[model samples]
Structure formats: structure tokens, C-alpha cells
Target: MVLVWAAASLAPGAEARQSAFDTRASHAVIMDYETGAILFSKNGEEPMPPASMSKLMTALMAFEALEDGRLTLDAELPVSETAWRRGGAASGSSTMFLEVNSRATVEDLLQGIIVQSGNDACIVIAEALGGTEENFSAMMTERARELGLESATFANSTGWPDPEHRISAADLARLAQIIIRDYPQYYSFYAQPVFTYNGIRQFNRNPLIGVMQGADGLKTGRTSEAGFGLTASAVRDGQRRIVVFNGMETERARADEAERLMRAAFTEFELVNLVEAGGGAGQVEVFLGQAETVALRAVEGLSFGVHRRDRAGVRAEIVYDGPLRAPVQAGDSVGRLEVTTPDGRIFSVPVEAAEDVNRQGLLGRAGTGLVRLIRGG
Candidate 1:
């Protein structure tokens, strides 16, 4: 059967206050990882040039290959003339100083891409994995779709300037979340400060990595067309936040804006546990069942992000169709317990049957029908 859910505000006049954050970036988004709630956003959905930030998608492809055994970390991939000329030293882009016709291990190349923002390394991996950079970009676009990145498109392995090579700030944040969630084993490469290849050592370009207390790994991007962009993630006390921004005027602005946004994300809001696992929200009547009623409970704990000052405005309600049919399983869905906070955020948790309800015997069913008819149920 189909169910329709309606939104209800739990607290009136408890709307979240406007965040006092001001950033120089034209597009930005800050999100809480655990709750998937957007803390602050400014033109976050507008697509803009992602520049080297697109390398995150490139890194994601490599990580997936590593996880699935299709590519090993120690596997050596060849550098193509195309990769060398266009993405290497000849192109005047970020390079890992990779030698033409030389081979680099997958692990080192990944470091080159992550730590050094090496456009050459990205092209090499793309060529190795997808037969050519063009094909690899197609793969990247397809993978972005598979991962639910709606506004992301890849024109090249390196986030080179292309009119079509654009991604929204929100999409970048989602990509960052996927990378951190799916590739924990390889995520540390993003945190590495420096990588030395071919007697050249380069530091990670991400501005927040060393300066921010909890900031760890991520990517930075810059091009004349895209200005500057950074996708940064940080964790503290088991909570993580992802921030994405683009179109900054300079590197210093990106760094300061990113840090301010991260700090506000962690400090401005609080996670509220509204209901515990197996906690009963209410009960529902049972029709033609051995028991007259069944208790409804949340299958897991329910939590929400709330403005710290508006804690008392949180409200919860249990909603479901009344008088459930008999032969109910212990975990059968009964209804939904919805909680809403002051900041206009709504969270819903499934409410399930607390225990099984067996169908009544023939006589019991007949009696129940008669009683229901007399009571006009």
C-alpha cells in the first residue's frame, strides 16, 4: 500500500538564525557528514568550473580500481606522449615532473595527483585505466552519474579549462563524502603533505590541510577561468564536515573562507538524539488479531541537527494508518515517527511493530467483525 507523508513544523518561531558567515568565494557549501544536513550554503547549486577539483573524481576511479583488484597499488602505468605533451611539462600545468615514456607505480601516481596536483599523473592513470584520456573522461562522467552526482561532468582527467567541464559546489561536497566513505584505506593519501618523484618534491596544494586543526585530505583547483576552488573535509570527535567552494579571488581567501566555514559547521550546530533504538513512540490498534493492539517502535535511534539555542523547539509525532491487519511480523513497518526542529530540518524514522501479532481464530474474527459493525468502525 502507498503512504503519503506530510511535513509539519514542530516549533513555531524557532527557525534557524541566518549564519554569520561571509566568504569571498562566489559558490560554496558546508555539510555535516554524519547527518547529511547542509549547514551553510551560498550559490552552492550553480555549476562553475571545477578546475583541479575535478581530480577528486579521477582519484575516486583509481581508488575503486584498487579496491576491486582491477589495479594494484604497485602496478606500473605507462606515460603516453599525449599525456606528456598536454598534461606534463609541455602544457605548463601542474606536473609531477614525470619523464616522457617513463613508468610510474599506481601508488606514486596517486600521491602525485593527490599531494602535488600533478596533471601529468592524472593523465597517465587515465590512459592506463581507460586506454586514453578521452575515454577516461567518459568513464568519469558515467561514474559520477552512478554515484548520484547530478551536476558533475568531466571533460578531462585534469580539471582543465573546458566550458562543459563544470560541477556544482554541492556536487563536489557529495563527491568528497563518497571518497571518504568508500575509500578509507586510500583516503590518507590526501593527507600526505608532500610527495617526492623524480627528485622533485611538492607539497599538497590544499590550504586547510595543515592550518586547520581537524582538516585532513582534499583537493585544490585553480585556473584563469575558474579562479580557485577547494574541496576540504575534516573530522573531530567522530564527527566530520565537508566544505566545497569555488570562484575565489586568491589562495589566501580560499584558505580563510574554508577555515571559517569548517569551524562554523562544527561549532554552530548540535546533534540531538530524539529517539533511541527500540523506543516506543506510541501504539496502534490491531484488527482481528490475538492482541488488541501492538506497540510501535523505531528500528534505530533517531537523531537531528538543530541550532543550539533552539533545542526546546524540537517536536516529534508518530503517524500511521490505524488498526493494522493481523498476522503482523515483528519488524513489519507500522508507521513513521517524524521529528522536526526549529531550523526547518525534518527527520523521519521508520516505526515498526514491536512484536508479532498473530491472526485471530475463526470465532474471534467473527466476534471482532460483529463488534466493529456495532461500534461503526
Candidate 2:
């Protein structure tokens, strides 16, 4: 049976729903890094051209390759003629100014991609890994699926405008989570301020790095079809948030919206620890056990983000089949704890027996049964 414990007194305020946050971007999503809670969303699930912001995927693929020994930082990859002709200075697009037929180390290429947004560097890495850019892009799409990205599709490593190239704002934030959580060592490349290749210097295009406190790594994108877009993450007071947005008319607009959403993400919400790990969740009646009741505990701490204004109430339910029959061992999975926020978001965690509950002897069990019958139980 489910036992609900509504914690209305935790915070003193009337029940209220979170107010909607407005944004100028056509697509946007803000998510808490720790809880993966979506603080705000606007057409976040719809697939749209990501422009160069998709380079996050390219960076992720390379990071994985380095992890599994498929590629090394110092490994040299040849710059093909196609890479130079299509992505080089002659293409009038972002380029690393790579000299055709010259080989560059994986380390330098990554800097080129992350810091310079070099289409040429991305192509070289693609060819080195998949033997061709087209094949590598297919690998990127497949890897995105493997990573559980719901709406990510890739047509090129550089994120050059292609009708088939698409990703959702939600997916972009999720991808950022992966890069930040799973690949911490390489993530610093995104924060590098400047990179020089072939005697020419370029600065990282991400606008938030220096402007926002605790802002670090990320990518920015823009194209005729996909207006200025950004996938950024920032940490403040030990909390991190990821923000993704697209379809702004100008770079300044994208920068403004990104900073605004990030600030609001932190200021407008509060992360509350509802229950501590190993803390008592609730109690459950035990049947034919030496103990009349058994305590329940959460396997892990439970935390949720609630709107600051709506910290009004949080409802939790301790659900289990009871009275549970003994003998119960400590740490046995017995039930689950369901926590609901004022905004109607529910978070669940498994609960377990906090102590042993040995079965009562036959005579004791009989006596208990008689007593229950007398009490009309």
C-alpha cells in the first residue's frame, strides 16, 4: 500500500505553479546539471539545424576515441585536399588555415575545432577516424543514438549547413551533460581563450567564458538557416546548469539570451535536499515478525529543484507492500520513495529495510494474531 507524506510545512507558502520564463530564441532549454531537471523549455525537443554548435558531438567523439585508444593526442592526421579546399581559407568559412597534405596532431586539431571552430580541423579528424568525412558523420549520428540523444542527426563533422543536419535544444543540453560529466579531462579545451595555427591567431568564439562567473567550456553556432545558437554551461556556488538556445537574429542577441537564461536558472530556482542518503524514509508494519514495525531508508539522497517562489510544498509518498512478512534483512529492497514538486514533477528513489525483522516464533505469532483479532484488525 502507498503511504503519502505531504510536506507542506517544509516551506511556508501557498501552493503555486512555476511561472513561465520567456525567451527571444525560437528554441531553448535550461537544465540543472546535477538533477537533470529541466528548469525551462521552449520548443526544445523539436529538431532544428544546430549550425557549428554541433561541433560538441565532434569533440565528444574524439574524446571517446582518446579514451579507448583509437586516437592519441599526439597522433598525426593528414590534411586531405578536400579538407583544405572545402574548409580552408579559400572556402570563405571558418578555417584552421591548414596547409594541404600537412599532418597535424590530434591535440592541435581539437584546439582548432573547439577554439577556432575550424571546419578544416574537423574534416581532418573525420577522415583520420572514419577514412572519410561522410563516413565519420554517419558514425557521429550512430554515436549520438548510442548516447541516448533523441533527436541528434549529423551530416558533417564541422556542422556546415546541410538539410539533413539537425539536433534539438534538449539534445544539445544532454550532450553537454555527457561531455562535462564523462569527459572532464578534455572539457577544458572548450575554455581555451586563444589558439594560433600557421602564424595566425584566433580566439574562442564562445561569449560566456569571461563574461559570466564560473562559465567555462561550450560551443557557439550561426548560419543563414540556423541563427546564432549557443550550448553553454556554468557553475556557481557548487551548482552547474546547462543552457541551449537557437534562432536569434544576431550574435549579441544570442549572448544576451544565454546569459539571461543562465542567470534565471540559478536565481529563480532552489535545490533542496528532501532526504539524506540512508536517512529514514518512513516506517512499515511487519507481519509475524519479532518487531512490530520496520524502518525504511533511501538508498541515495533525494534532491529536487523547485521554483524559489513555489517552494511552497513538496509531497512525498512511501510506497510498499505491507504489512511486510519477515524475516527481513537490513538493506533489502522493500519500497520506493516518490517525491512530487509543486510544479508536478515527480522523482522516485528506491527504499530499503533499515534493520533486520526476524519472524516471530509460532507461539508468539499465534498470540499476536489473537491480539489483532481482539482489536478487530
Q: Evaluated with TM-score, which candidate comes out highest?
A: 2
lDDT of each: 0.82, 0.87
Off by over 4 Å in 1: 1-18, 272-377
Query: Top model by lDDT, which number?
Result: 2
Q: What does candidate 2's lDDT look like per residue over 162-253, in tens digits?
A: 99999999899999999999999999998898999899999988889888998997999999899999999999999999989999999888
Per-residue lDDT of model 1, residues 255-278, tens digit only: 887777778778876666666899
Root-mean-square deviation of candidate 2: 4.9
Residue 52's lDDT within candidate 2 is: 93
TM-scores for candidates 1 onward, in order: 0.73, 0.74
